[model samples]
Target: MSMSEAHERRLRRATRILDIPGMIVGKAAAWLIVPMVGALVYEVIARFVFNSPTMWAYDATFMLYGALFMLGAAYTLGLDSHVRADFLFNILSPRWQGIIDGAFTLFLFFPAMYFFTVATFEYAATSWQQGERIPTSPMMPIIYPLKSVMPLTGALLFIQGISELLKSYYSIASNRRFRDEDGHP
Candidate 1:
């Protein structure tokens, strides 16, 4: 197969795998968010009507919201939907844009993610070992599942960063200059 075909195939695989986290997060959201919302509303009602507050609602919401946001990062990167400045990019050709994009992924994205993964794992492990629990009236037992999301998202980002690097490197190899948006040579 030609490099173009190979690139397309690889991109397709990457795009699909990159979406796994988002799908999982989206599904998890139904269970997590629904209850959290219900609990918050219930807690508010209890506090006002009965003069009693639910201690766990705030913590539950934090975890649910955190999971939703962190798990979506991989999907965001896959779609190239992460925030960027279009102003300067409007001036460059596509291939050049690809090259610059790859450089950033290589030097910045990969290393940063690697460190984040290590740090997250360490913290999660410690929390799990200690059997961490919320220091509140309810004293809910907090586990490491949500804590593990940090490293998992980092890993997804790392995979996506390499995929982007390969696309950029391929572009640079094909021509010193980038093609237009149409991808014509």
Candidate 2:
């Protein structure tokens, strides 16, 4: 194989290795929907049929939904499902696309993710230290756990971001589309 091809293979290998944990975490987070839906159903039944409302339901639903949303980000990135202005992007050749994408990933995407990861970690740490709870809730479910998800999500996204960056670099170097795990373009 040519040097560029070997380099591309290595980058692809690295991306695949990094993708595993993000896939697992994202898929696991998807199961949170079951509990979120259950909480909503319970609240509806309790409020309308039983003439009583639940204190925890509102908070539970939002928290669960938020966690679900945040945690699925890395998975979404892996699938390349995040929104992009693909109308113009679709017209570009693979080389030009890779150039733009690699540049953006390096100069913009990585920095943003790094700052987000750092900030969320500090936020979670402070929340944990303070024994924080949802101040608005009567039951006041301990919020540190929910707060903790932020950093976890950030870390996952960062991991996936590295994979994406590598893919971008490989594409730019090879002048071709980076193949998926199944070897699809």
Candidate 3:
């Protein structure tokens, strides 16, 4: 293989390997929907039929919904399903697309993610240390664990970002669409 081809292969391998964790985490997070739906349903029944609203249901649903939304970010990114202006993007040649994507990932995306990850880590850590609970609710579920999801989501996104960076580099270097292990373009 040519040197460029070899480099592309190595990068593709790395991206595929890194994608595994994001896939697992993202798929696992789907299960959160079950509990979220259950909480809402139970709350509806309890408030209307039994005339007694749960203190924890509102808080639980909020946390569950937030967790589901945050936790699925990396997974959505890994699938390349996040919202983008693809109408303009799709018209470019693969090489030009790669160039733009790699530049954006390096100069903009990575820096933002790094800062976000660090900030969230500190936020979660402080919450954990203080044994923080949701202040708005009388039930006041301990919120540190919920706060902890921020860093986890950030880290997962960071990991998938690296994989995306690698794919972008490979596409640029090879002047071709980067395919996965299954050879889908």
TM-score winner: 2
Query: Per-residue CA lDDT of candidate 2, range 86-136, in tens?
Result: 899868876788888878888898888889889989999999999999877
Q: Rank the candidates by lDDT, best first.
A: 2, 3, 1
Query: Which scores better on TM-score, 1 or 2?
Result: 2
Ranking by TM-score: 2, 3, 1
In terms of lDDT, the poorest run of 10 residues in model 2 is 1-10
For all candidates in order, the CA lDDT equals: 0.69, 0.85, 0.84
Off by over 4 Å in 2: 1-6, 179-185
What is candidate 3's lDDT per residue for 61-107, written digit by digit as tens? 88988888888888888777888898998788777887898898889
The model with the greater lDDT, 1 or 2, is 2
| Model 2 error, position 142 (Å) | 0.9
Model 1: residues >4 Å from true position, as ranges? Answer: 1-32, 48-51, 136-140, 170-185
Instruction: Report the C-alpha displacement of residue 128, candidate 3, in angstroms.
Output: 0.8
Residue 79 Cα positional deviation in candidate 1, in Å, after optimal superposition: 1.8
* Candidate 1 local lDDT, 4-94, one digit each (tens): 7687566546645655665565456446667768878888899999999877777777887787677777656655667889689657765
